[model samples]
Target: MTARRRWSTEEILDAAAELLRTSDAESFSVRKLAAALGTDSSSLYRHFRSKTELLRAVADRILLAAMDSYRPEGDWKQRIMSLAQRVREAFGQQPQLAAVWGRHASSGTGSRLVMEEILQALRASGLPDEEIPTRYHRIAVLLAALIAAEAGVSAITPEEYEQGMELFRVAVLGADPGRFPALSHFARDVRPLGADRHAAFEEILATQLAHIETAMRSR
Candidate 1:
């Protein structure tokens, strides 16, 4: 009798990640995955005890792939911007995975590695030791914002999204024009500020890092 070939954990994860990349997460069922892999769903259970665990594994795999491609040799601000852009591209490529990656607690090894790299870069740039945590907090916030923006952009139809942006502009302009004069004047152009969100996020990250560096040096 011939023995059945067992699938490795990495193989299962790769299959799951591909599923998420090509389709929505809603379509990622064990049965569907098994069918795609030409195996029984029971076989998958041997590798992943639950769907959540499998999803996390898939998220980790994709995130690590993203981190592997990050290469920055510049000042902390430039490095961070480059890193942020890589992250944005990664999540954009696999949007369903992005939603899962964004929600998971940053406790996994992959998550830790990414954070450690960011912290190391910041430390190398002369950010004070005491302020390192604050710098990371800012980076985390910017990362979360980028993921959220990408997710939002992926969820809406182009026409509906455009109409929604127009509605947002009207609402903002309707609010205290005297207090937000510039916003009111540019309301048409200010419609939710969705163009090149990753670039906008990079700017925000750079500004925050600069502010932190200045404050730490003063203190």
Candidate 2:
């Protein structure tokens, strides 16, 4: 009889992180994780109280890795943009995890690391210390939502995305020209030649920063 492999916390989390990258939501359970590590479910249970806790740990590891890989070497805006882009790209690579990233609880050690990185960039922007906290919170939330939308769609199978888009296009074409003229007119180009996601993100980020800086100047 084969003996079960003894899994370390790091080993388990490592496998869990990889599993999250390739597995679907339904296939991402503690039992599957343990099996992947050549251990039993009880072995995983010894470390994590539940599947949710286990997923949270895996998520933290992903975030931690993302933060560590970032090398800041630019202006304040560039550094801040790099931070957001790096995290987004990291999570984006593992579409499964990226899909549910924002739904999970924050304030973990990994999150603290990321937050500190962002605040550091903000400090370099020469913002008053008092306004940093509020700006940090707002920007963090906005960055998360933007990344989620960008990466979550990526996590799905191409077939699924194409199928959804097909439906969307059909609906757009079916819209009344009198009432939804704008949408109907642009139906062909909506998906066939859509705007670049990264460019769209840059536009949004620039607008938000412009508004925030204007408000700061007035106040």
Candidate 3:
């Protein structure tokens, strides 16, 4: 008789990470993950009792892998910014898992360690002891939102994006210039939203970090 295949937790997480990295977040499912692993969905239950649990595990692993080499150095704000960038890159690589991270609010060992690092940075920056959690939650949400936005951009086909741009151009040009002056003026130069998303994300994050510094000084 042929022996049944046994999957390790690490092996399953590796497959799940690959799926999150490549597949649209909405397309992720236990069946899909199982298929990717070349095993039946039921087999996964041996390691994870539910899809939610499995997804949380995947999310936790993704963040840890991203911050594996992270060591706090430089100014407090700079350290936080560095960690934030790592967070963004990690979540961006596995966009689908972003939702899972947010949904479960997973506190696996790796994620807890990440939280500690961020909180430590915030403490060093002089954020009030009581305000750290809120700050952390806000930053976490921002990172997740960015990842989701990146996933949305990836889902769009180039042809569709071009078609949308042409449609927008036609609408802006056809409208009365005086009534829609701003749109009319920018129509010729406006770029698609996803075209420069990475830059936009960096700008937004930079602004947020600046706010933290400002808050620290004002307090």
Candidate 4:
């Protein structure tokens, strides 16, 4: 009889990512992953210490993919913006993974690479050495929080998401014009609530970048 092929680390991570894509991280387990791979759970344990370790590996894999295509050739602002977009796009692929990273602080190689890239960009911004760390922390946390928020939207059904947006629109538009004249007057501006969620994200990112730029220019 032919022997079954042993699963590689890459294959295991790929399977885990696929499972995460369909089901949430809460319900995912090493046993379930082993079943999907047609192998014993011990095979997976040989590669990873535990489920948390395995998931962190998966998150690193995704970050590696995000960095694979990243080119840090642009100026500081542009490079930082591009990196942010790449990170967002990577999480967009498997938003469920973002939630995992959200709950657990990521300390993987991929996460370190991202931090290094951000620090490089911040240095290029002409920020003082002492201030770089603080700025880096702010930028990193901002990106993580915003990306998690975006992923939260992806976690829900399209209909439910749109319904929530519509409800916000109604709440704003239905307000008494006399009491909330400014809000009511501008409700039409936000009429298309869910049409371009990324636009809002990009705008917020841009604003934060602009603030950093202003600080850099002042120094």
The models' CA-based lDDT, in order, is 0.75, 0.76, 0.78, 0.86
Better of 1 and 3 by lDDT: 3
Please state the error at residue 54 of candidate 3 in Å: 1.2
Candidate achieving higher lDDT, 3 or 4: 4
Report the lDDT of model 2 for residue 124.
Answer: 83
Model 4 weakest lDDT span, ten residues long: 188-197
Give the per-residue lDDT of model 3 (tens digit) for 1-219.
876678899999888878876674467788998888788989989889987888888888877877797889987767877886787677766566776676675768778877898888888878888988888887767877776667666655689878887887678667688898898888777776776887888888778778877887786
- Candidate number with the higher lDDT (2 or 4): 4
- Badly placed stretches (over 4 Å) of model 1 are 1-5, 105-109, 155-186
Where is model 4 more than 4 Å wrong at Cα?
1-5, 174-186, 191-195
Worst 10 residues of 2 by lDDT: 187-196
The predictions' CA RMSDs to the true structure, in order, are 3.7, 2.6, 2.7, 2.8
Q: Between the candidate structures 3 and 4, which one is better when assessed by TM-score?
A: 4
Candidate 2 residues lying further than 4 Å off, grouped into runs, are 1-3, 25-27, 106-109, 185-195
Judged by whole-model lDDT over C-alpha atoms, candidate 2 comes out at 0.76
Q: Which 10-residue window of candidate 3 scores lowest in summed lDDT?
A: 147-156
